[model samples]
Target: MLPRTSFPSAYRAAPTLCRRCLLRSMTARGQQSRFISTSWLEKQDEAKRKWEERAKLIEEGKIQHIWDTFKDRGYVKDLAGTEDQIKELMVQKRIGAYVGIDPTAPSLHVGHLLPLMPLFWMYINGYRAVTLVGGATARVGDPTDRLQSRVPMKKTDMTMNITKIHYQLKRIWLNVEAQATRFGYEKEPRIWNRAILNNSQWYASLSFIEVVSRLFKGMRLGPMLSRETVKRKMEKGDGMSLDEFVYPLMQAWDWWHMFRKMGVRMQIGGSDQYGNIISGIESIKYLRDTEPDPDQKLSDDLSNTPIGFTVPLLTDSSGAKFGKSSGNAVWLDQFMTSTFDLYGYFMRRPDADVENLLKLFTFLPLEEVSEIMEHHNQDPSKRHAQYALAYEVVGLIHGLEEAATVQDQHKGLFSKGGATEVSSYPTGGPPTANMASAFRVDIKLPESLVLGKSITRILYAAGLADSVTDANRLTQHQGAYVGGAPGQPAATNRGISTGELTFTPIKNWFPQDTRNFLVDGKLLILRRGKHFVRVVEVVSDAEWEASGMMYFGEPGTGRVRLLRDALMTGAKEGEGHDLSALSSPEARRDFLDRAEALYSDEAGRFKGLPSEAFMVKKTRARQILEQSFRVFARSGNQSAQAKTAAIDEVLERAARNLDGHVENYMAEKKRQEKKKIRTSRPADEKSAVRWV
Candidate 1:
């Protein structure tokens, strides 16, 4: 170690300021050792002194208001400053702001709402709002979500997704145009002003030198290393590329450009973006052309610049993130999520989150929201809050008229007072039966959404299907109603169009989860009930012609590696020719074939491991192999039955060791029992049923 005298007294002394004080001071001063204003320093000290008092007030509801109430509804925390910052920003300058969207898909999803809310808030509050479409960024996919790197898109595909996303946004925001239909006018919220922008407009025009100068001038490696996200990845010994490391830098550059060009002063995104947000503020302060005065010095505070805020992840009742039910995303585009399906999803949100959902995603006033909350609390079984929440959000997204129509259709067929079943909807759609006033979606019947499901299952959900015999004869004797018609004499092999099907009941019941089935647009809705809708948006003709998936009939590059590995593994294990002998492409095809065979042979044994192992590769394989080894350790080579018995024993023991920590827990429990339960029967005897 260096001599003690080498260190300064300040370094040796314990820190006088608390962490929050330090954070504030650092944010205020930012790299400067010198203080600016005496009052500012005093304010910091006061904040420290009164921290507990302010926290108590915040907890006790003294500071509660519309904004605070909104925050409680899942609005992000740690937005630059307190209420003082908001007042100051409003007084100082009319801040211009933006939210970024990458045109990676044809539609938006509910997940994208987090940033959109802030953009709307800024727009409504006397600030200029800009919606930045990342036409350029979409081509080079953002690494935020993907574990592996994304394949760079062709310029044409990028252009198409960008155009598609633009239209979807217009629908979401209810953009006004000459072609605006009733759906656009009556349902969707009109939030944006005149400033819809594409970052490609600026980024495309920049020279290489200009790009470098703007992005790299003051960015050093030290700060990058210190970032929590980066540090976490490095500590895990995971492979993080230069691009992954530099991604935040690129995002920071985007903010700097916006700040300089549009006077944008705030950035809001998911919690994952905190590092990028901080970097953006740093870039704005230090990289701008205007320099600080000779007398002025940098302060430590980071909160004084463009504000950074992040919302918590949305989760379902089971405490898992929303859209994680089956490990698939519920996309916002009509092709990805149907309007009716979307409505039903919001309907299923837990009562605990109704207020948060409204505050985060809707424009409901505080008083109305409170009333809805009270109604929900009074009789949760009534599902009043669920319907209202779903109706308002779906109307805002798809249009009020459509929502009303869906509701009317639902009531006509399913309501107890209405018809008990629906033979068919007037429009060409699914032949639905057993409709209910009480809305419930079927995730498995998009084909039958209003048309195709057997009347029995529809009635089953609606309490109509009583037994197998009742269902079988109803179809056998042509007694079943379909699209307002009696069942066909025999099951036909030919495919039936939507118009051809007829229902017997003829009463209207809203299409149970009919949200995905769009009637007019080329995009068709397919529902798996209320919860699962897949929107297949019509690709532009040009896009269709250019797509390899459309013309060549195959998935694109960078997706065949796993299939190839599987094939090779199967071949090696099966005493067949080596898959390695084939070219990479051929190997991939072979792997997919073998993998499919294996899947068909033993679905339960193969599905979980193959998908999981293929994705994570080496790490997961090692873990599984190690566990398997431990399980087989005591199972020596012997007759199949004896070996199997030994294996089973070892596995049970391992499971107990892994899941229950049985040995340690049992030892501790014995000690506790010996000390505490003196009069009881022997500890093991109570649980035992053994015979010697």
Candidate 2:
């Protein structure tokens, strides 16, 4: 089907704990969440109940910390810094967990959900959330998902994108916090206290030399080069530049600064960013360990050392990525990607992907997601899992109201067997296709074409059976049925048997069927059998004339597309005189052949033709060809003398308009040169020349 257009982390125990010894002692966390109905009100109530149950688990030893619970639930991927260290720190303090986002676009897309959603989790779990806008990092684009370096954005464009993303991120973060607070999850919601920092502020003051020598003093060269993002680019022979190479260094500085200044204890990112996450953690540990203290009390206290973890990148079984660079991404901001478009993207999630996407992307309980999948699998056609996934993801990002609005619009399109209201559908297609099997009615035949036209001509114009002979053979079985109009009540009443199929007009069956056969004065749908259907639209002759386009079809179907190539072939020295029409496949092919030959002859001699001769002669030639075409179209007969007359008249007017246009072009060129010379002249010389 052709598309018309559419639109977390916890910290660990103190570093004093021996890493090898504690690795064996680490206990995986678990929690039970209550299931809620699809009702929004019930879901709100369920949230409060789940929080109460979570409190019990925390006391009963079923769960170590909320961050650990998240890790065990399969949210964290490529986790860096031990679980032992992170869990201990979370238990002792409410640490700030930060995720940095570069504002390369004015809006964030679905691909960003892997990293950005962690901030929401941190807030609901009573951890401080910091969503950083990488205003500076954006200037040096992230080399994470690109094969080639990005074209730099203008300052005004970058600033605009940054400001818009700031508002979008803040809005979602605040809404999530408010919802959690209303559920009594947190009396003093940490989300209200959350921070949205911009890295440009720090980078603006920090110099390149300072970053390399001081901040990166503890960083190793081997690890930086071995990072996956860097490795892939180098192996591909499209290696990253110095600016891109040091991007992680700047990101590391982000973590180091946040750890010391704001006390952010953890950094979270997508699987692709685990390498950068590690770099930040290492740089932070180095800075913290190097901090001078007379008592040396903090030396062994990995107590508050920053730790980092990554969320698994969502992928289909084929390993095609699902987020930002996946190419099929949708923007988070409603204005950029319309509400209907964003909702539809998730609602159409492939069955194989929906189950995993539900687990990774949404806040729904994993068990509930399983239940949704069971129901979805039972009736795959119903797409219950897709709806639930779309609902939660859309509600999370765009709020419940916007989500509901889009869902309603989507249902209205497909709920009643695809575009139920004929008035609402586009002239060229259904408002929304119900399935891939639905036939598209895209061809716009001239209104004049419908009157007494043979089945062969109709089929050819509609692009259904290829040629008139093919159309005739396909209809021989009497399997054709055509009806969908004011006079015809049923969907199929007409048929063409093999004996009556040859060169017969379809209007013979229903008498005046073609007069009102078009649904809403535009569409005609015909079914060849149970499996094949085609659509034809009757368009006014004026419309076709204005467009100048010969046909609407799939690639390689446009009849006149070869006109230029044919003309080029005729330009050979010995070929110019052989102007006879070579092929005659259709009624109009002869005229087309002659027209192209004439155009080629003129074009070949274009270099030597005079302005008056070229212009006056071509003007007359156009009139002759147009009149000949009209006569041929009406009766498929144009005399040889008429074509010769067109050639002679065209020669008289070909060059009439050419000289005036050339003179005007020369005058403009001279004016521009004078302006350039005056501007380049020295100030003193320019003043003396102007006075003279």
Candidate 3:
């Protein structure tokens, strides 16, 4: 820490003053301690000229050249500062801005998007960005914008949350950069870097007294108490704890630290943080003035000063806050909310808020936004603006391919009188690719299979549509859909299901450039309804067993190893733990029962591990187990009846009725299926009936 400047020795004994007033006459020692200059700053006149040009751009609200928002809708207003100050720091000095979020959860929802939009603007317009996750401050908890106080989070939980958020922030920045590249902005000489900062580094080491001295020494009780956040808490008279009151001070300190350490001058936050932002600005100003540095005189220009900007509270046309608090906020994580759901959410935005949301959430040019709004006005029902907004936002969050899939699914499914039924005949892409909206499972075709065979055999071999009796059962109702030749319209083929056909159809959904995925120069993709998809490669059974493929955990867990050993020795479950005994339906059922219990237990306790590494373990287990059951169910094995029965029960248990036809929530998927079973099935058939 730099000490305050003292008066020159010559004036120390003189009748009137302390060294604070005579800074210019400070000793050589004081001068060296206070001043350090960098080439990042420019000459006084040059910087001032640049500032003037930017200020004009700001006043005009024209992002024509610099592509930043100052007085436009993007600007909610600076924290009691002039627009010129904002422009000067952002444009002329090329300073960085930041928006700090506490890692209260694993993912960021739409509520965090508001502040990030401007931070994105700053990034593209040649400003640096440092996104701080409040790893330390989260421990103390911020009292702003809350009716009740926050419960403290465990260290492990906070650590896990930080890891997940760090991943998300990095992911978002990459997409932003890619967007920038398309805009030809990165070609400029400036290098853009997005930094992820965890606040624990500084705060974790400081003692309470040290914190008070470094940050709160200059904070006044009157002003702190008078702030809206504090006043509200006081009004409730819950006898506010010192921890809650100091929450704002922690945020203020964060800004001050960023300014000093990372050269981050602008603090961007939501409207709720207006008071905390101001507090930071005050503390920074006071510290700069009091820190005894001779170099500070060389930088008397206002460009070095810290400033802040706030985003207005975002809401929908209904006046409800655009947040998860209302239980409708969209999440960035796919597990919490699917890509299709996100697309639908934005695509159905009310006309009143679509334009504003576009400007705020997307990087589209305002001129283009205006044009889209015009087109939308001409035909509101066409939803031109809403579709554009949805595509852009979804593309940013996921990718262009994912967004395109949603659009295709929506258009294909809704084009026919809002029909949820899929065409028995191929409608969109190639017949095999038509099921692309659902899923992709990899399997192996029998080496002896011949081309131009039958589609029903392929479905059975892929463990897609259960038993022939089940398929017949489904067909007798409305008819169950299955993938085959693009032009074939049969709901189910009688020949293949009953083992009458020996050859298989070559029709597949696999990509044309498939050098990497092919086995024995042959790979097939199959689909059943809108949700179920399977991939089969033509590899001999002998070749598959010799391929050294073990589907289990890294290095194979003990259970997986035991199972593999049993498969080699044909030992029974408890006696030798042999997988060869898996032929027995009883053995298969016993193994699945135990495996199910183990997977459920691990999934239930996954949070006990580092979330970044283990969060998806349970989901993966269920998926692999489901696919495994299908492989066995379709195979030729001893004790056929027992094997088939055991495989069916386990597959049903693993799937939990998520088979292709069982629609969860999305109606769009219902329309993507190449074949539709419009008729309802018996309750037992609709559900995965118990066998054991």
Q: Candidate 2's residue-wise lDDT over 393-426, tens digit each? A: 7777766665666677777864412231121112
Q: Evaluated with lDDT, which candidate comes out highest?
A: 2
- lDDT of each model, Cα atoms only? 0.50, 0.62, 0.60
Stretches of candidate 1 above 4 Å error?
A: 1-73, 80-83, 175-194, 234-238, 289-304, 322-326, 412-692
Worst lDDT window (10 residues) for model 1?
433-442
Please give the TM-score that candidate 2 achieves against the real structure: 0.50
List ranges where model 2 is wrong by over 4 Å: 1-59, 62-64, 181-184, 187-192, 207-209, 292-300, 316-318, 323-326, 415-692
- Please tell me which predicted candidate would have the highest TM-score against the true structure: 3
Work out the TM-score per prediction: 0.47, 0.50, 0.56
Collision count of model 1: 56
Q: lDDT score, residue 303, model 2?
A: 53
- Give, for candidate 2, the lowest lDDT window spanning 10 residues: 496-505
Q: How accurate locally is residue 91 in candidate 1, as Cα lDDT from 0 to 100?
A: 39
Ranking by lDDT: 2, 3, 1
- 1 versus 2: better TM-score goes to: 2
